[model samples]
Target: MIGALASQAPANAGSPAVERGQYLVNIAGCNDCHTPGYFLGKPDMTRYLGGSEVGFELPGLGVFHGPNLTPDKETGLGAWTDAQIVAALQTGKRPDGRELAPIMPWHAFAKLTRQDVDAIVAFLRSVPAVKNKVPGPFGPNETPTGFVMKVVPPAKPK
Candidate 1:
């Protein structure tokens, strides 16, 4: 099912970074949450990486929304530095000091190669910027006490 959706976008033609990033984003299933309509196997290309208002409800945790990854200045990552992007993926900490919900899979992503991480950021920068404001996550009880931080292995040697 996921394979059918993987070929929709070819690698970015102009930049190798963007191309690699695009490929990584596709294989990593970033679109599953970051891109609306993607999980249904029909991504809205017009709003690619624009984020979603639809929320995910974790059994004992709470509701969470995916934030825009586009370069939009108002509601996306335009203001974030590439380093910040890498940090978020590694530590699950947003630039504003907020922790991302476990649903973000930062633990798995933390092990991505630095080159891959940089490529992801480059791809994010290359995508069309869209203005979308995702709401903050809401927890049933104060942030889940069962939240356990995982130890992500160091990046693989190239």
Candidate 2:
């Protein structure tokens, strides 16, 4: 699967694969959490793919911000290596040695072939970075408060 995305990855410019990645990024629900303020509206197109902050005040959840997912030189994944990204999604660890908390659905994503994952990352790399400062790695699910985020229900294990 890695070959599929890499095969179509545009070298000098954004390729069709990257565009597809962007589409998947949205369809896969990456925007819901990675992009904060989704309740109000999408982030400015100028800051497409930029991360934001939203407090998770539910019982099992805690206050946290969705950090920048853009390719900005400063507050984004610009400095991260593809390996770092793949590892984070597959292993739940940040480049800084921090656990990404279970909020991010890297589990479901982890099933995707390496190539597809790369395409998503490729699309992320192509987007302009936003200067949003995400807050925390809010641990645990909030079962109390009015909010109850349904995590991916379990499927028969392979």
Candidate 3:
């Protein structure tokens, strides 16, 4: 499944960095969350990495949709510098100082080598710009705008 999806994107065949980045992104399962309709089993390849329609509902942190990773100026990461992207991935902190949602596995990503992170950013920037405005990181008390997968604590054993 991963191979098939990765193959759909146009590759920068001559750039090793882009290729490596693509490999890292595929292995990291970025599409599973960032691609629209993915959770519904019908990912939109045309808007790959554009954003998710589904949101993850943490117990107290609220709902967060996987944001668009494309370089769209208005709705994606186009405004972010390469350094900003790297920081977000490695430190889980956005340019605005907001921490990534709990569901984001940035802590695991934090261990990635600097070169690997750079490659990831390069690959993200190379993808065709997709203008998608993902919905909110709704507060715990706020109602979310789309389908959500809630994370609940396991019940105590009897």
Leading candidate by TM-score: 3
- Per-residue C-alpha lDDT of model 2 across residues 1-158, encoded as one tens digit per residue: 22322343333345766877766776786666666555345434444446655544434555455568887667888889989988888888899998776567888888988878888888888765667656544456432322224344468989
lDDT by candidate, in order shown = 0.76, 0.65, 0.91
Model 1 gets an lDDT of 0.76
Error of 3 at 149 (Å): 0.4
**Can you write out model 1's per-residue Cα lDDT over 1-158, one digit (the tens) per residue?**
45544444533647888788888888887877877666555777678788865666665667677789999989899999989999999999999898887788999989989998998898888787888777657675645222222334578999
After superposition of all CA atoms, the RMSD between model 3 and the true structure is 1.2
Worst 10 residues of 3 by lDDT: 4-13
The 10-residue segment of model 2 with minimum total lDDT is 1-10
Which residue pairs clash within candidate 3? Answer: none
lDDT of 2: 0.65
User: For residue 152, what is the lDDT in candidate 2?
Assistant: 43
Q: Candidate 3: where is the Cα deviation over 4 Å?
A: none
How many Å off is the CA of 45 in candidate 3?
0.7
Candidates sorted by TM-score, best first: 3, 1, 2
TM-scores for candidates 1 onward, in order: 0.77, 0.71, 0.95
lDDT of 3 by residue, 47-77 (tens): 8999999999999889999999999989999
Instruction: State each candidate's clash count.
Output: 0, 8, 0
